[model samples]
Target chain A: MVEAEAELKRLMLAGLAGDAAAHRTLLAAVARHLRNYYRARMRGAPEDAEDLVQETLIAIHTRRDSYDASYPVTAWIYAIARYRMIDHFRRHKRRGGDHIPLDDAPELFTAAEDQASDARRDVMRLLDTLPAKQREAIQLVKLDGMSVKDAAARLNLSESDVKVSAHRGLKALMKLMADAGP
Target chain B: MKTDDLIDALARDPAPPPAPPAPRRMAFALGAGLLLGVVLLVTFFGMRPDIGAAQMPVMMKAMFSALAASVAVPVLLQLAKPGRPLGWRIAAVGGFVLLSAGIVGVALIGGDPTERFQLWMAGAFPWCVAIIPLLAAPTALLLTRLLRDLAPTDLRASGAALGAVSGGIGAMVYAMYCPVDSVAWVVTWYSVAIALCAVLGAFAGARLLRW
Candidate 1:
């Protein structure tokens, strides 16, 4: 564990000094660790765990300057991860557990279909609350599964702008969802 | 989006342009804020008419305010970054508070009992408390912006520290126009004003400092 901490710290410091390759390596490693951390805590919700892993990684990347050399890199990463997880749970609680399971084998297929459509409806409703650009960016890139290049071309925005809008849109969605809850 | 794809996107984005070290950035921000506060001070209140004759008290006020700022500035910088142990810095802030209290205690004990109330109230009680925070506004706003750029895990604590440091600057500027020489009055009212700034900072920080 200590060796892992040292290696991660070294990579993080190098990454902060404009070493893009080192940053990529560090992020990949951090993502692996976050997956396990969230998976263990969020049993039976692998998709949610993956979503959190992505959210935490984005946070770590955006806020990299906040990292201080005096502390272990894992400690800093986990602190951010913990914050994201708490935020996730808060939003999750507000949404409430509305999922219903149909146990009969004959109904199982239809139930899955129903859930997917219900999820799509919920997403569209939430997306409507975002700014037009953010909503469009997320719809094309995230929901429609378009590449950033394609989405950017369609929207007349730069590729980075598409990514940024999607990121911001997701953050806003989380906030909106949390507020929607009691 | 898949986690791996998201990672790739994040990595592909360019690294932020190089930033000045934390201490340098902090110094620049606070210095600029102080300059604004001083400009406001001179334009409005002007220096105390008797500033030349009130050298002793003015110097004393400057010393106390400077000491407070010295204690707060480092801690504020420390709190702006995450994962650093604040044990010693927190202790140092506690020590400064004790020292301020000690000065007040000595003044109260050594002075005549009949003048105790006068010493506490001194001149410009209302103005001191009100104007210090008013002057601190620029510094507080600047520090908040800086802290947002930097990562602060505990928003409320960071905000309170920001407030305290700005309040110190405000008190320092207020001292130039404050003619009261009583150590008790300076210690008591200045501390109160600084605390008020801190409370306001905590409220603002909690709302504004989220990542």
Candidate 2:
């Protein structure tokens, strides 16, 4: 993992030179890389998370040759993952549920007001009150299957802070749900 | 909701029917780009000395390169995939801008019909390097959306390849209608200009257009 990118470059050069076997080998390894890449980014459940990885891998395999040798493969790969996540949210919105924002670009923050509505109506219905950022941390890390580090990166907070936030968010949410007295 | 419960809520939600109307809009972008490429081509041929004249190869070589870049930029931007899908308005906008680039090239090349068009190419050739993307964002968005729709299992590569080729056609079309007679001239001056537009479009789309 430490020298993974360097190794990938060597494999890519081999593929460019028309090594068919090298291309297959590189493709297989990148699939694993894609899964881990996605896992860290998502802060949700395990089930759909793997599906996202597989879908992204399919995208990479289908379009691998387009990977510019001049660019970093890792960022290119993550960009694909990020788009798929957006696609996922769009699909979810169609199903009558709340959607999440995967804000990779400034232009993509369309309908911030709508997302806020969704947060108040749906997310608050479940968690009672834990503040927006705390709820987001729980949503991204616990349910979305994103690791603390990746969620922290997305949230622009230290990992320790996110850990604390998630802890508090979960505790408060549980108490709120429990107090509903079912 | 519990974490899994929330996940379940999201998962159980049904995906909407495929937005079939979107593809037609995307195809429209492809068509617009193709039209622009054809325009470049037409202007380029119009600039040729005459249909029957013996065409010199060296000048032809330089002209073709210029023509190719002008064409590639709009098409490449459309085919790029960084974010949400592109729409028809974007395609229409790109077509308009690429058309303007062809017009600009026409102005510069319409002079001195006796001069060999290729010689001047070396001097003003790389200008397309700056303009293609700057003024042609709609075209870039068009290309990006076009590529995403063409993501078929087997024909994906074909989609990308066709995008580049067809885009060149649109650029060429714009070139031909430039009111210039020397194909070499249009290819020399105008082709270089549009190609610069294409490069700019692709670079901007990479970041600005990414989802």
- Candidate-wise lDDT, in order: 0.81, 0.50
* lDDT, residue B155, model 1: 74
For DockQ, the strongest prediction is 1
Writing each residue's lDDT as its tens digit, candidate 1 over B70-126 gives 798888988787666687888998999999899999998888999887777763545
lDDT of 2 at A10: 77
Q: In candidate 1, which residue ranges exceed 4 Å CA deviation?
A: A1-3, A39-48, A85-182
- Every model's DockQ: 0.23, 0.04
Question: Model 1 chain B — which ten-residue stretch has the worst lDDT?
Answer: B1-10
Residue-level lDDT tens digits of model 2 in B1-211: 2332322222222222233443366457756765554454444344444433533532443355444534443333434433222356346545645764575467456756555344344334343333332323344456555554433221232233333333344443333333334444444454445444444434443333322
Q: Candidate 2, which segments miss by more than 4 Å at Cα?
A: A1-79, A82-182, B1-3, B19-25, B32-138, B144-170
Per prediction, fnat is: 0.44, 0.03
Best by lDDT: 1
lDDT of 1 by residue, A1-182 (tens): 35689889989999999888899999999988999999999999988888778767777887787888877888788778887787567445534334644554555565567657655655565565466789899899988999999999999999999999999989977765553331
